[model samples]
Target: MAYDLEEQEQIDVIKTWWKQNGNTVLLGVAVFVAIVAGIQGWRYYQHQQTTQAAGLYEAFQGAVEKHDVKNVRGIAGQLMEQYPRSAYASRAAFIAARSNYEGGDGKSAKAQFQWVIEHAKSDEIKDAARLQMAGVLLDEKNHEEALKLLDSKHGAGFDGLYADLRGDVLLASGKSDEARAAYQQALEKMDPSGGYRGLVQLKLDGLGG
Candidate 1:
């Protein structure tokens, strides 16, 4: 049907408006689409990383269950190398270190502990690594070095263990007074019902405290 004069004039006005503003509108729409695409792409990348980390963790578990320390170390090394930013990698490094320690390879255990101490995102994990490393160093009679590592800022997370090891080191170094204080501090931080409480108390009494 043919439009009347008013309708014909309205159509001409609409056409003119589109011709003048069309490019800007299309450009705005394109920008919105690109932003949405970027967000989705980032989410997809994160999901992929999570999935890969999970798979690597499962492989580590399998090697552990088989009692294969060598295989565990190899797989855990790959995981840490490729996914160092992942929590799974941190956990894998800890487990691998423990496995190495149990298998009588203190050097590998020390390396793994140092790696976790330096690289873990979680402060709690880093403190735990430091604690273990200190214990190993003490066993090696590197008392001064162990003290330095244990001197790290563990805050409340490792108060008990730090105090206990510090006491041990002091006792070994024949600083009985400082040793007694450290043992007392350890006992105060420990659970009253804990078995270590009695041990600490005994040590304190032996020091004539």
Candidate 2:
């Protein structure tokens, strides 16, 4: 509210209020400044974490490309321990999982895949992790566990792969009819233009009528 500067009484009232409340007002200002500084500090810390995690992920990818499975696993473990929530951590885990699997370390591969499935922010990444984990289970000939993993909810785009893997599990379990149905469902889910369609068709043909 505006008052006439000529009002001496209002001026006197303002001076009295300020004398009583000035310290409280100053305290509020100090608190606001501290809060803003704290936010900036936190943001800077997060940026540093992300930058470091990214550098580590680059190193991990390089290791993967060079087929240095030991280095890949080491870097991935560091990321998981130090920056598990960072975006790069999950990606590093994915690469490391593949590396370990190819290196004949199925147990390490499963653990890394589980980490991605549990910690990845993206549903697509989680879906892919589950798919790969199921594949590992299939390789172990743990058909029931593989089927359970394959039957879990996945991304729509993953349906064909899920179904195909499911068919494999069923066939291994000695359920030819269920395997045939799953193979058919895989064909229906797959895109006709996809090169893998021919592979799935071959599987279906191999199953025979």
Candidate 3:
């Protein structure tokens, strides 16, 4: 083909520009492709993890419902150990703790509760673990330790329950006046429409409020 002088000049300039910068452009494109691929790979891996964890969680639930303590411990332990980053792990810990507590294994129950308190990403779960652990300590007659556990900050929604548990610990320790005060705080914090308000009032009445 033939080109006019002006057209040839423009084509020459484009060729020169490509000769100087084409490698950099290709490198940039390659890097972008690698990054996109990497991101997709990571997303796939996370999805697989969540799917596997969910399956394990469902199995744990079945074990719990059937009162299969051995299977519950085994499956829950696997979830906590292998999938600790999953949401299922925290829930598994809670279920395992309750199961252990019910089966008269307070030591294991306390350990599982402590794991949830230490590792749970959710503040609500941690607060629930702390409250349950305090109850376990109270059952063991470790009054001071129970009180100490209940003394820590709980989630805003747990304030009333925390105060109520604290009152129970105080009452157990024979601190009647402090117990009454805690009961009053619980009542104040509790939502009037909540069922727990009635329970808290009963505790207050028991304390001669």
Is candidate 2 or 3 superior in TM-score? 2
Residue 70 local lDDT, model 1: 82
* Highest TM-score scorer: 2
Q: How well is each residue in 103-190 modelled by candidate 2, as lDDT tens digits?
A: 8999999999999999999999999999999999989999989999899998899999999989888988889899999999999999
lDDT of each: 0.90, 0.92, 0.94
lDDT of 3 by residue, 102-158 (tens): 999999999999999989999899999999999999999999999898889887898
For residues 72-146, could you state the per-residue lDDT of candidate 1 as single tens digits?
999889888988888888889998998988888999999999989888999988999998898888888999998
List TM-scores for all candidates, in order.
Answer: 0.83, 0.92, 0.89
How would the candidate models be sorted by lDDT, starting from the highest? 3, 2, 1
Q: State each model's C-alpha RMSD to the native.
A: 2.7, 3.2, 2.0
Clash totals for all candidate models: 0, 0, 0
